[model samples]
Target: MKAAWYGENGGPEVLHYGDIPDPEVGPKTVLVRVEWISIEGGDLLNRIHAAPSSDHHIPGYQAAGIVEAVGNEVTRFKAGDRVVAFDWNGSHAEFFAVPEHYAYPVPEGMDLRQASIVPIAFGTAHDALFEYGGLKAGEFVLVQGAAGGVGLSAVQLAARAGAQVIGTASGEARLDRIRPLGLEHGIDYRNEDIAARCREITGGKGVDLVLDLAGGKGKDLLVKALRPHGRYSVIGAAEGTLPSFDFFELIRKAMQVTGISFGRDMHTPRVHQLLEDLFADVASGALVLPIEREFRLSEVREAHEFVATQHPFGRVVMRP
Candidate 1:
């Protein structure tokens, strides 16, 4: 099998594409012939920060394709079944092998390209907003880095549930692109003050919930934008370094901070049902995640670089 891999953590330059041996199918494994791979934020983060367990580590989390083979213990899936699979790594390859529990059946007739991006982005947003953050309808929610895949998913889901959504983007054009998805107020993070804007948008009471996706130096402002005892959902840190909570800050506001790692619950029955519903909605056109660009699997290096520098409006995908 041909795949992209790296021996050590570094920039995109560390990645090299070449032929590698196919992964062995375990008793409960589902082997997928990768068709479409979603370039997740975590993919880029892991390449730069996380150490590879082996010299030939293939890094990626989500992908959709046909099941080329299924383990004898896998009862729900068989060869030729269409599905999306998730693992800690190995999706950045021609053949992706995952445990049966981590694979979700892609609805029949849905485009594989679209199914490739659904589970992680939508599942993460859903869990952060309702399951853990406890977001309620008619409450105000602030989404930092609102133009990315998970950010756009959060905007849509929150709005559909009747919550007022305030999102931060780089500029007017990007914000305008997101408004149709249910952003009530768009804050230009490049020029405007996020905390002040949230206070103004919520009539000085501050937002009821804050989803911090772009954690870095700007994390302090997200905390300040929250109302007293508000919920803060820590999702991702696109800026590379994660933000730390201050002891006094936590004590001062009596706020709730929850770290959301959707992968932790992805193999559960709860997430499976949630993803099924989300997939149906996306296939029916009720939910949309725009693909800003597509690249061949061979161009994995260039694709990773584009995501790191471009700040694309929505998700980017690669075909194998």
Candidate 2:
């Protein structure tokens, strides 16, 4: 099968697209003919930081495709079923072989392109907001880097759940785009002070929850924006600079910081039910995950580079 892989960690330029051995499907595995692969933030982070398990390591996590083969033990699906699959790697290829537990059946009427982007982004946001963050209706929630995939998902979910959603984007144009999706307040992080705006928006009471997707220098501002004992959901670090909370800082506010890893729960009944509902929402036009850009598998380097530098609104997809 054709794949984009690398022998070592580096930038998008390190990726090489060519022929690679087809993954062998095991007893509990499902082989999917890849249609769309979502370029997640973890993909870039893994390319630059995570060690490769093999000499030729394919990097990606989420993809939607048709099931070409199913394992002997697999009872949920069979050949000709459309599904979205997730794994720590091997999604950047023509055929993705994953355990049946990691595969979610796409809704009957949804496009493969849209189903490909759902699980990770929506699951991560759902867990961060409700499962870990303990968000309540009428509370104020601030989503940093709100224009990205997970960020947009958080804004929409929080807003729909009745939380006052304050989102941070690079500019007015991007912020304007998501307002209809349920952003109650927009903060142009480039030109506005997030903490100040949050304080003002909440009438001197800081936000009840802060979803920090951009984990660089902006972290302090998010910390300041949170009210005492507020929940801080650490989901991703788009800027690549992770911040550590000091002992004094934690004590001063009695804040709760939770790190979200959606993959950990992908096989659980809770997440399975969550994805089922999410898939239905997208298929029925109740929820939306926009495709900011699309590329072919051969342009792997350019696609990864565009995701890192272009500040894509939702997700960047690749066809194989």
Candidate 3:
């Protein structure tokens, strides 16, 4: 098999695509012939040795593929079954293995490339908004960095749930792209003030929920923009510094500030049900995965470079 492997932690240039030994399936694992794999920030982290993984690791976490074979204990899936999987690595190659519980059947007529991108960004957004934030319909929701992969997913999901979304981007073009997503307001952080604009959009009541990805001074800004007793969830820091905020402000408003890490614990049975619901939405044409670009498996370095640039309006995938 041809796999992209990194012998040491470094830039995308370290990614090597060549022949490698085939993976051995475990008793609870299913071997998949990967059709598409999604690249994520976590993969970059692992490549740079920032994540707690082995040195020469297969970095991809989400993939859409067909089952080639199943281990002895795998009963739910059979050979030739199409599925999308998450919270596992080794999808950068043509073949990979995962636990049966981690894989879900892809909905009929859904594109495999699009399905590959769902596990990380969409799954995280779904868990953060509904499960953790308890986001209700008709509430004012603020999403910072609303043009990135996870951010865009949150925007669409919140809008689909009948929430009034206020998306914050850095430029007019990105802001323009966010406007048609049923957002009530679009804040260009490069020109407009995010916290003040959020306040104005909510008629001085402030946003009911804030999905903040760009941590920095924005953390403090979100604290000011949130309504009393509002909920705020932070998943990433793509912007400036992450400084300590005023603890008194959170105490005064009785705000709930939580940090979310989309790990195996979050991918519980209940969470898988949410993913299935999302898949249903996709199948019904109510939800869409807006892919900005696609790369081949051999171009793993270039794919990582593209994501690092942060210019894509949607997800990026590697078609194996």
Candidate 4:
């Protein structure tokens, strides 16, 4: 099968597109002919930082396609089924083999490309806003880095739940694009003071929840932006900066910090139901995720570069 893979961990330049041996289906795995690949933040992070599993490694988190075959032990899926699949790796290829549990059926009337991007972006944002952040109606929620996939997902979900949504982005245009998606206030993080803005928006109390998508030095500002005992959902480090909280920092704000790894819950029954509802909402236009661009699988390097540098509004997809 043709794939975009790398022999060493580095930048997108390390990636090579060519024909590699097909994956062997395990007893409980389903083999899919990938149609669309969602270029997730973790996919680039892994390419630049995580160690490769072999000399030439395929790197990606999720894709949507048709099931070409299934293992002997797989019961829920078979050939010709349209599905979106997730795994630690191997989605950056013409075919993907994932455990049966990691495969989700795309709802009827949903586009395959749309289904490809749903699970992670929506799941992470949903759990961060409700399940973990404990957001309630009329409360204030601040979404840091709100133009990207998960950021936009968060803005919509928070707004739909009746939480006052404040989001940060690079420019007025991007923030403007986000406001109609349920953002009550837009902070241009490049220019405005996030903490001061939050304090003002919440009448000196600060936002009830802070969803940190662009993890970095900005964490300090987010920490200041939260009310005492407010929840902070550490979801992504798209800025390529990781922030650590000290004891004093935590104690001073009385903040509750939680790390969100949506992949950890991908196989659970709860997540299944959550994605089902999210998918239905998306299909019905109650929720929306914009696709910023699309590229051929052979142009994997260019796609990665675009995502890292362009700050795409929603997601960039690649096709085999």
Candidate 5:
């Protein structure tokens, strides 16, 4: 099968597209003939920082396609079923094999391109806001990097749940695009002070919760934007610099810091149910996720570079 892989971690230039051996289907595997691949933040992070587990390591988190085959042990899915699949890696290929549990049925009539991007971006945002952050209606929740996939997802979910949403993006145009999705206020991170803006927006009490999607130097500002004992959900680092909290920083603010890794709980019955609902919501147009661009699998290098440098509003997808 034709696929993209990198021997070592670095930039998009490190990625090479060629034919590699098809993955072996295990007893519990669901083999998908990949149609669309979502370029997740973790996919880029892993390529840049995580060491390859193999010389032919193919990196990606999610994809949607027809089930070409399924293991004998797989009972829920059969050949020709449509599914959106998740795994630690290997989505950037012609065929993606995942455990049956890692696959979610795409709603009938939903586009594969749209289904490909739903689970990770929406599930991660949902978990960060309510399940872990304890966000309540009427509370002020600040979303950092609101233009990205998870950021946009958080905006809609929080807004629909009755929370006031404050989001940070790079420009007025981008922020304008996000406002109708239930953003109560928009901060231009490139031009405005996030901490000061949050204070102003929340009447100096700061936000009740902070969703840190872009992790980097801006983290300190997000920390400051939180109210005392506020919840902080650490989600992603689009800036490519991993941020850390010192002991004093944590102690002084009395903040509750929770690191959200949606993948850790994705295989559970709880998450499967959550994803099923989310997929339906998306299919019904009750939820929205925009795809900024699409590329062929052979153009993986250019796709990765565009996502890293262009700050795509929602997601970038690839076709096999």
Candidate 6:
């Protein structure tokens, strides 16, 4: 199998594409011929040693592919099945092996390239909004970094659930892309104060839920934009700073704060259920994964470089 891997953690230059040993499938694993792999910030972090590191690591978590072979113990799928899998490394190769439980069947008629984007960004958005935040219809939701991967998914998911969605972006072009995804209001954080704009949009009641992916004093900003008993979910920190706030504010407003980290053990039946729901939405033409760009496997380094420099409107995928 051909793969792009790093023997040591450093920069994008460390990624080298060449022949690597094919993954040996375990009894509980399934071998997939990867069609498309989504490049995420987490993958970049792992490559640069900002996140977890492993020697000779192949970095990629979400992929859409066809099941080429199955293990003896695997019962959920067989050869030729089109599927999407989440949280699997080594997807930066022609073939990869993943546990059967982590794989989900892609609905018929859905583009595999688009379906590839759902496992991480869309899954995280669904888990944060419904499972963690307990979002209700007719409520107000605000998504920070709305132009990025998970942020765009959150915007659409929140809107699909009947919540009025507000988003924050850095420029007008990015905001314009977010508008058709059901964003009712957009704040240009570079030109305007996010908290103030959000407060004005809600008429001072604040939003019922706040998804803060850009950390900093944004925690305090979310607090200001959150209504009483609001739910605040922290998913990422692209802004590079941490802020402090008074504990009394939380007690007074009865607000809830949660930090979400993705891992192997986080899988549950509810996650499977949400994936099913999201796929159904996609099948009905209600949900779509906007592919901002695509790169070949050999251009993996360039893909990471692009994502690092420019904040794209949707996901960047690599066809391996």
Tens digits of per-residue lDDT for model 5 on 1-320? 99999999999999999999999998899999999999999999899889998999999999999999988899999999999999999999999999999999999889999999999999999999999999899999999989999999999999999999999999999999999999989999998999999999989999999999889999999999999988999999888989999999998989899999999999999999999999999999999999999999999999999999988989999999
| Greater-lDDT candidate between 1 and 3 | 1
Descending-lDDT candidate ranking: 5, 1, 4, 2, 6, 3
Task: Please report the TM-score between candidate 5 and the true structure.
Answer: 0.99
The deviation in Å at residue 142 for candidate 1 is 0.4
Which residue pairs of candidate 1 clash? Answer: none
Model 5 is weakest, by summed lDDT over 10 consecutive residues, at 47-56
Better of 3 and 6 by lDDT: 6
Model 4 C-alpha lDDT per residue in residues 30-123, reported as the tens digit of each score: 9999999999988987887789999879999999999999999999998999999999999999999999989999999998999999999999
RMSD of each: 0.7, 0.9, 2.3, 0.9, 0.7, 2.4
User: lDDT of candidate 1 vs native?
Assistant: 0.94
lDDT of 3: 0.81
- For model 3, residues 1-320, the per-residue Cα lDDT tens digits are 87888777778888888778888989998888999988875676566655535555677778899999999999889999999876556878888888888888898888888788776787888877887889999999999888887888888899989999998888888889877776668888778878899888889999999898877677788788999999989777766345465778879999998778776553478767877887887778686667888899888889988887767777788876
Per-residue lDDT tens digits for candidate 1, residues 249-276, read 9979999999999999999999999999
Report the Cα lDDT for residue 199, model 1. 89
Clashing pairs in 5: none
Q: What is the TM-score of each candidate against the true structure?
A: 0.99, 0.98, 0.91, 0.98, 0.99, 0.90
| Candidate number that wins on TM-score, 1 or 3 | 1
Candidate 2 ranges with C-alpha deviation above 4 Å: none
Task: Give stretches of model 6 more than 4 Å off.
Answer: 7-11, 48-53, 240-254, 262-266
**Between 1 and 6, whose TM-score is larger?**
1
- Expressed as tens digits, the lDDT of each residue in 160-221 for candidate 6 is 88999999998988899889998999988788877788889999888988888777766677
